[model samples]
Target: MPSRFRAWELCALMLAVGSAFTSNFAGADEKAEGDIPAFVGKDSPVGAWEYGKERGEFWKYRNEKPTATIDASSVGKYADKLTPGQIALFKAKPGYRMEIYPAHRVCGVPDFVAANSEQNKTLAKLDASEEHVVDGVTPGVMFPQPKTGAQAIYNYLLRYRGVGTSVSAQVTAVSPRPGSDEWITAVGPSLNYYPWAVEGHNKVVGGGAILNGISFTYVSPAALAGQGGAGKIYFNQDAEAYYYFTGQRRVRRMPSYLYDAPQLGYENEYLVDETGVFLGPPIDRFNWKLVGKKELYVPYSSFGMYRFNAKFDSVFSKSFVNPEFRRYEPHRVYVVEATLKPDARHVAHKKVFYLDEDTWIPVLAEDYDAQGNLWKVKEAYPIPVWELGGTCDFLAFTQYDMATGRYVSDQTTIGQGKDVRWFAKATEPWMKSDYFTSQALQSRSDR
Candidate 1:
């Protein structure tokens, strides 16, 4: 096994322009794209050129959805082998079909578990809505043995991801037109700071209500370039989000920015809470129910999605991300179903999430409309962040608009020369608290 790679420094910046990225293929020794060496995890089964494994004629299906028929005759044999959402997806007949791979263990953070053990000597309960953690919150998994759906989701959402992560470049793409080989892409840099998620520290640092603070600046698509802002994910309340508009030259609070709000770019393909499947506050408008566990083919060890040297043409298909570059392992996942409350409102009336049992990171999520029709399906690619003591994180994810066949993919280093920088400690200047405020957001805008 390869040794864990060290965290990259913040100085290894990617130029704000999309043209600054390179698309040429790389060899086995394609290390150190900039000041810091790129990482593919210690236990990853591939080299720098994971894209070399793509099959011949795979590109032939670019203009169409999955050609294979999936019905009672085809799905009968595997009916019991997959989740209801996965089954529903099969019926939807996507361009890419499911491919199951061998299961493996995804590493977890040691200090996080240690801190979780120390801080949660007495586990706490959720608030009246059973969404927010009322007490006993710490850096690691919020609920080790979660009996409720809310607790399981809390475990998935609050898992320690080092102090935070500094993304060098995450490219988001909305699927292109049929027979037209063009993609609408966005390039950006993101900073996430966990106020109380610092490792080796058992107690909360900042207010626990504010779990994480994140800021983003996009540098591509000229119209929105140099625009950025910051926000905080609260424990019980809606997030506090602010955006600094380069055109306006001012910072404005996004009062209604949380949940189902379409992102600024991507032609309404990306939503505010769609990233990572669910970045919304826990105590929002859903009533969560523990749906037990199931063995499903979930994305795991997705080194192909992290191919900083691979071209976007190799991964971004018309309807969905190229299935050849995606890997699915058969593992037990904690299934949770969330439904809109009696008086609640949102675009998605129902949401179901499949979280990896070991790492607690959600691998697949399905959203339903008010009439119980499958609306959107999302999948996240998990790669071990070896620098953070072999802990796991999802830097690549995609959401498919089931209705229009349009899809939005993001948090990827694919085709970019640099990779997302993971930090085991909060040492960067941007990871501080004040930087996430609206005032700091205005001063920090790239304009």
Candidate 2:
């Protein structure tokens, strides 16, 4: 996913005279254009981009309302197999469809087991040591109990939608640590969707080359909401490229903003290893479970009843990720789970995620401790804006300690406005690495 700040920096430079962002494709399906409303940009805050009211309205206008009712009993005939009810649901949503088949029987393989063979052998040797060791008389901190094997069930399903690669993430606690406030930030070349933090100068910086090596950026402030100047932000790549915002309004022009739908991985299994590095290969080896469909009120995006209880694993019956003895409620999205290759660097033993079906967005995630307990829970959401084509322009994501109250949430893409020319020519010369490096920032001193 393009960095939120990088997109903002590019959006700032493309200042067109009028409010309407011109169509990228001439004769671009008037139907597609018609599907979206006109000139909603001027009335919106500059940096608000994650899908919001404007895009939501377009979705509502273009697509027919789905019949919200479903026959529960008939859902089973297609539980492991595609049934007629499942087909009906898919037909109701535009640009959407469903692929239902036997969970483990598809490739003529036996059902995928969450807590069977290999996983136990691998997890058996982990140090079942204490959660934490404290100084002097204070008792050592006890981390949350390890996750039950159920998370493996969750991963087996979510992997089907993602590139199934090792995504990058960082957990941050407040300055003092273990307080009421915290944050978390996760980024990939193709997507950036996280939860908003209530307060703080939670900032994150990251970017890479676009078409022709034009680099990008992302940033946020300590406190959001009503704060006046804290969120001040901008992007500059020489005279040909200038993108910045005075408070909320944008001023400048440059190409290489987001909305380009850049690819993050080379193939389904390879993380795009060019400018940005993939931690590892695609997460393809797994036993999967397609739990039919259901309705879930996830963080940012909401859709009609869709697939539910999707789960998966790394290789075969091994379950070393979320551990086998942890107890979690059924309603909690703890079922969606995955494990990095045992040897992959910076990976949690098992990571369980609660995902939104429509957008393939992860609302919450559970990172496991060495002993397989719920180490941290990560949350994410985006700010809605029009100039960004009615998508989230800002994103805030946080990770909290499940046992202790410590946590951290990084905020990125927090600014406003747009330059039409820069947006249209997104993916250009100025957005390269030399323009945004530390040497560049240190050499020039003016905003």
In terms of lDDT, the best-performing candidate is 1
Least well predicted 10-residue stretch by lDDT in candidate 1: 17-26
- lDDT (Cα, tens digit) per residue for candidate 2, span 81-167: 222222332333222222211110000000111111112223222122211111110000011112333223222221111111111
TM-score of 2: 0.32
Estimated TM-score for each candidate: 0.80, 0.32
Extract clashing residue pairs from model 1: 65-95, 66-94, 66-95
Question: Each candidate's lDDT (Cα)?
Answer: 0.68, 0.25
Q: Global CA lDDT of candidate 1, please?
A: 0.68
Compared with the true structure, what per-residue lDDT tens digits does model 1 show for residues 58-80? 22222233223334346766666
- Candidate 1 RMSD to the real structure: 11.5
